[model samples]
Target: MFFMFIYYFLFSWNLAGVFGVDSVKSVSVTEGESVRLNSDLTEIQRDDEMTWKFNNIMIAKLKDSKSRFYEDNAEGRFRDRLKLNDQTGSLIITNTSTTDSGEYTVIGTSTDSTLNIFRLTVYANLSVPVISRDCSSSSSSSNCSLLCSAVNVGDVTLSWYKGNSLLSSISESNISISLSLPLEVEYQDKNSYSCVINNPIRNQITHLNITQLCHMCPDCFHCGSTEAVIRLALSVLVGVAAVAVMVYDIRSRSFQQKREQTSPSNNE
Candidate 1:
């Protein structure tokens, strides 16, 4: 019984050594901002050695009241961006960008080891959504075609909403690219419509102006369509010709009346 207790104690101690007191944390920050990964330590001891790693590659270290930063690691992705706290052994990344997103691990050792893991996610600042008329999609005079667009967005959803109701939505992941969504509405409709672009962190919105966007003529004068331009030109020409014909007719009638009044039969 005494030998069995000794074996059990040894197994438990081995397990503890293998998996030390681990604390995991998740952090998110926008691009061009700073984020700090806490070490959960009140203070660094005299004999404690703390090391910070990015995806298992050493980036920083704190030992004996001195802090060292390896800013050239990870293919120079973290160049000049790492800061280590000598007192608490925390890691601070300044002016972060989307490329600086990944797993971070901090290991501290003295008599025993303690581990703190952090998953960092950095997001780019969102751009305002753009609203425009979709001229090609204007199928009829009563209906108007519209398009909402955003550029250089990643892991975002572009959606069209009508009076708090969802109409259509599209999403993209990982790749940064331009996105556009189309909506069709009636020219005389009086409902509120809006376009939204959102990510996990924040959202951008643009309200739709029905009167300004959905014209009664449906891109006749707004979109500068070739057919509309030709029609305008023909209308101008017709008005000019009608005015010329009217002037000629009025002059001819006046001359005929004067001749009739000056005739000998009229004088007798």
Candidate 2:
């Protein structure tokens, strides 16, 4: 079982890496908010220059010995909107919009042909969600599941909550806007749960309350009722037996007393 778990983990991780980067990376912004993306060079010498490319065009250039590339390119719908800090090799795109959705590739030259690559993804706002669930109302209490669903959402997550308190959560995938949470449901007392569906793709929430309305009580009607009746009958029977025994003892004692007082042999 443990080995199977390990293999499952590795396989899932591999699958995530393979299918994870499917969506255009999203960044949330107000009307004029700035965001940052850091591109690091791994196994590369410090004397290398890093370059940020948007749509195959050089957007910003980094000086050698500086890890950052600053843009500050606020031209053509980006007037004072783009800021690229070349020293840290990070990009700060300001005043972002939906049209800003495109390929952003950062390339760092290594000694070998191994170019350290960083993809800068950008996204904004949220999408209307199409959602679903995995665990049903009839599911057992041991392992319950609920899935919130959507489309075209990259890097989203699903959080299960009972009221304000978080019950459980599951990470979202690239292809799917769905969130799956495997949880232990309380058999009786729990109810009215919701799944907050959110990630870099969109922000929305879905809910699954325990639809089966239950009055909180252990049922004592049938079996307990029978037991009470049986106990009452047994108590009545014991009372009658005790009364008969007491009456017999009293009658015997009285008869003995009468015989002693009226002493026929002694009188004769």
User: How does each model score on lDDT?
Assistant: 0.84, 0.55
- In terms of TM-score, the best-performing candidate is 1
Candidate 2 Cα outliers beyond 4 Å, as residue runs: 1-33, 41-49, 63-78, 108-115, 127-190, 193-202, 206-268
Clashes of each: 0, 20
User: Model 2: per-residue lDDT, tens digit, 1-268?
Assistant: 9999999999998876654433235445432346676554333344766676666666765566543333444235444555655455667787677556556766654422213234434554444443333424334323333344445445656676788998766664564444345544544545676657666544676556543322121343222234455776899999999999999999999999889988877688
* TM-score per candidate: 0.79, 0.33
Write one digit per residue (lDDT tens) for candidate 1, span 116-167: 7888999889899999888666345467789999975588899999989999
Minimum summed lDDT over a 10-residue window in model 2 is located at 214-223
Model 2 residue 50 lDDT score? 65
Clashes of 2: 20
